[model samples]
Target: MGIGARALRQRVRTAESEDWDFSEGRIFGSMCTQPAPAAVAAARRFVTSNLGNPGLAPGTARLEEEVVAVLLDLFHGPAFGAGGWVLSGGTEANITALWMARNASRKREVVLPESAHFSFVKAIDLLGLEPRWVPLDDQGRASLEDARKAIGPRTAAVVAIAGSTELGAVDPIPALAELARAHGVPLHVDAAFGGFVLPWAGPAAASVPFDLAVPGVTSLAVDPHKMGMAPVPAGVLLVRHREMARSIAVASPYLSSPQTTGLLGTRASSAVAATYAALMGLGHRGYASNVRRVLDLTAQLLAGGRALGLRPAVEPTMNIVAFLHRNPVAVQTWMLERGWDVSSVSAPSSLRFVVMPHATRGTVAALLRDLGSALRRFPP
Candidate 1:
């Protein structure tokens, strides 16, 4: 309104316009690709079969309850005072968790590692709570000592990341739990990646527990959309204690579904049905194997990186791999020209990769080749 209206309106119209192929984005980000190893036929069948009937009735509600129960068992909340809600995606799940932790504890400050998903910061901002920043170790794992320094009476809760977004670092949950216990604060785990992989990681560790099964983990946010390989907009927040989730449970009888917890609105049972089908589709062994494959790829590529003289940021134990190049901008451009999409990451100056389900040995080999060539040609 302040400037030339005609030019501004035309410029705005142009900016909003583009022929973006929706499926192209999913081509690389096929988190749901594992659900249907052959194709999405099986996953699609599950969605169509359940949602084709239409309308959110009592049957749909049961389906929602079933998915929640399965996730609760998966995340070690079943035995404790476990409860959860089916969510649209990682953001909603995180938002719900932050809100719950704030309201339940009635405190002004929450502690989280610097490497946590950005949503935690966003959630804190939106919810108007102070986040006490915890630094990470050399390996990117959040430091318990740093978190301990940040906590006191005003510390409402401690949020630990099971699988960090940039580097896939798993903070020491048991240590953080001890800190939370000393202060009588609830501990929340954001396992957006590790939730699906923890069960697999635990067995190979040849010993102890994985997640909330650890005594101190009171709640977790598991994104079905990320590791569960469900369709987009699928995530679940599991609280070890149902009373903890009580903060988000609205009691409006006039709306009809008084028992439900989460953002008050029409629930999408379709995503839940897809998630249930995906979990059942893989079973435990298949998922474990898949996790190992990505980990193996991570190792292989990290080795390749070392061979090529690219300094890796952390020794990866999960799908994400990050490293600093001598000249990152040029390296990224050269790599993109050759094909393959890599992302720039903060916290450490580096390129980050999600070794998704599609990345095979051959694929990794090709990527490594490009990486080596880029390093050789890198500007000093």
Candidate 2:
């Protein structure tokens, strides 16, 4: 007395249809986009593989290793002694990095900027560590002078952001690294959104040092699922030295691997395969092309907003753009009513737009039309 596979498929499709499709390009609020076709196909092929027990899925484990190696190289980590793992996402990666820092230093305080991602809040709470919050400057970047004041004997780590969540602000990582080095504390860079985009973002981004190549950076987190066009739940954590990761390893007697380094025990290997596929298929030139395309679209969005008499909170450093709005909540509601999904930020009271890969010229034009209408209705 059970429904057959055909009926189940039909019912699932019917339910899924009610959700917003990224292909339609109305999902302006999300960091994720429609995954690359090659990545999706690769994921389906390895759906049954589990990387947690490497003994069981050796092929998938090797793929994960290759993915990590490529990402480390991209971040300019040392070729041989560096270590990395593919975790669930940025939150887990951030927590794991902080946990390692706390354990290694045996300290309780973490120095971070106000613009850091909310994931740091969870990490601090879970690890029983105190946070020394640094204020942001007029440009929304973390104040370097304040950060120097915050670092002290009890500081376990210094957290810098390469790409912040709400404002897409890239903190001055090289200077922060110098500060952390002076204090003898690990500096962790959360580059979840910018890691992939910044590498190919042309000359402006080239001058910023936000990776392991910078002297004092100990660990860094980047998400392949964000700008890499990979499936969700694919985050990479790269450490400057392999021994730094040893602080968090726990023995797993039941699993094929002697120890598990990440928070999850049964991780989906499909994500690993998809990440590898996306990285290999796109290569350097392909990603550079994609980044240029999105950045161009971002410029269009900014110009369109300016034409509507709306000003941006800050000049965008990445694909994410935000406009200063008097009534952000009302504008968000108005857009939602018209089937356009966008987000709002509280710090500067702005409406946010993330131009992911799914967003095209046509979609951006449509969104601007609707946004203009919303602005007129709300008079923001």
Candidate 3:
């Protein structure tokens, strides 16, 4: 009531100006994406709806169910009725799965690779579970041999990355699944980066078994916000059986249903609607096209980096391409000064680039040109 609309609009414009333009396609820090217009429109349409309390918005609940169904099918899982829920992002989805796994296995030990996302550290800290860190293989995938030795009677679950955040290396999931089956433990695949891209990544992607169809993978976390071009705060945690959600579900007497299985209360219905719209609007073919383009850009990025004398840390399995440099910090600084938003990978002392929908071919070529100039100055 106090501030005029004109002033408020000015404030919003000022704030937006401070942030980097995503459409410029220069950011390479995190999995930042330009939300698809269809998804954004859907979010705007459902902005007032609430998904936190299902009883209050049964229609939104149905839409959420549909989103889950689409994701499940994409991940090659069982039918929609099996189990899953849309959450905020990979972190929440990961914690929810860990909570269920801890309860289901009746154990407090979780084993994952060092390459696992920092979200697992939060899970271990929040849940009071002991974490056993396994080493990564030469390719940056979780070591299958070490995983076999890690699982024991107190082991709650083993986590395998579908497409790791740093180098985008897909793990030996089928082998890890076999280990889980042998140990009678749950295996959760963190497909936050790959889930939207891999299924449509052509026949070559079939070499990596990182889907629910694999024998012993019991659950997974996939982010619609990452590669699905959905608005932010849209992630889905899926499990093999519906009963899995039952174990750690809490009873919310105030809500329509007596039990609530999700990790968060008062979720944004807009995100759910947007994710649903993205799946429906793009479909499989649309996503396949997007992945193909991203992969192509990634190839260009790799080639450009190599031509500039930087070596790739790993063979890119997905849309992420990282190259090790003699002085990554200097390169990052140089790129930033030139209006590029790039990040450094600490593990291999490299520069990371995520080729997503926003990274157009022309923009990638421009980036390569700039990168060449930066290398000439920095010499690394």
Candidate 4:
């Protein structure tokens, strides 16, 4: 006899209960938050739809288009000629961007920062492209001088990180864009985390230019799942021109669309629905409020760490905070033992924390109390 739905659900819930709950606010090392209620509902409603064969799910496809359009406007892309797709998250989006660049330029070298995500490593390996790494400055931003030296005739694309994973550093994108323009190569900004945060970050982030609006920037990737209060598997890839994506297209003879542009074949429409619902429900003001709350929480974390004799690695540029530590890995292990899930960064040898929306004042206080005890034990 088949198992009943109630029993199956109970078994699943038992398994899931073992995992850390974001609402408890112990997860400080991740970029993702507990998705918005509306987003969750929309995702559930569209769980069976698939955009891979758009003819069968035309409404879902249209929803995906609308999501792309909204993101393009948010990122300040060109009003008319820009195009995008909702793919499987930053890795696929990054790979797709490089694939397009490699096909368009027929070049093997990609200039990028040391702070760039590990996804780029996979991208270059899979695409048969070479990475010309540029060192970062004291502040974790990419060194523009080294980047200039790295670019050459063999360069396919210049990769910049708008929100670095380790230190939350924003690279000198405007300068890099100009350099790429001088070298006649395309610029791809990995704003997977910042794309949703920076726009609403107010005047502090206004001076930074890390999108398609800047000249020489051909493509950009952003994740709605990170800071947009959307569920997982929702990444947006925007290109300055519609034709730029054509380089990576392959014929899908049996599908509703003659060609597919991304790495995935049968993507879930749940992500599309969830992303659209998140964007539409929150809008600018709602997201701005979310950003404000997280940023404030980040500030609190930094101040608390300082009071505990922990030094910040750098003044935080976003909701991410890191503190200099003699043994970050040991600290991470200690925190894990205590039921708090934090991370460590290698480059600066520090403990890392991302103050997502799920994190609250009470949680920050609880984390600080544990951190002080950990510091007394670790002596750094």
Evaluated against the true structure, the overall lDDT of model 4 is 0.92
- Give candidate 1 misplaced runs (Cα > 4 Å): 1-55, 78-80, 202-210
Off by over 4 Å in 4: 1-7
Off by over 4 Å in 2: 1-6
lDDT score, candidate 4, position 77: 88
Reference-based TM-score of each model: 0.85, 0.98, 0.97, 0.98
Pairs of colliding residues, candidate 4: none
For model 1, residues 294-337, the per-residue Cα lDDT tens digits are 77877888888878877778877677788875456677777767
Please give, for residues 1-380, the per-residue lDDT of candidate 2 as tens digits.
Answer: 68999999999999999988999999999999999999999999988888889999999889988998999989999877998988888999899999999999999999999998889999999999999999999778999999989999999999999888888899999999999999999999999999989999989999998999999999999998999899987888899988987888999999997888788899889989999999999999889999999999999999999999998899999999999987898999989999989999987989999999899999999999999999888876
lDDT for 343 in candidate 4 is 97
* Pairs of residues at least 3 apart in sequence or in different chains that clash in candidate 3: none
Greater-lDDT candidate between 1 and 4: 4
TM-score of 4: 0.98
**Per-residue C-alpha lDDT of model 3 across residues 297-377, encoded as one tens digit per residue:** 888888888888888888888898888777878988988889888877888878888888888888888889988998898
lDDT of 1: 0.73
Worst 10 residues of 2 by lDDT: 257-266
Cα error of candidate 4 at position 240, Å: 0.4
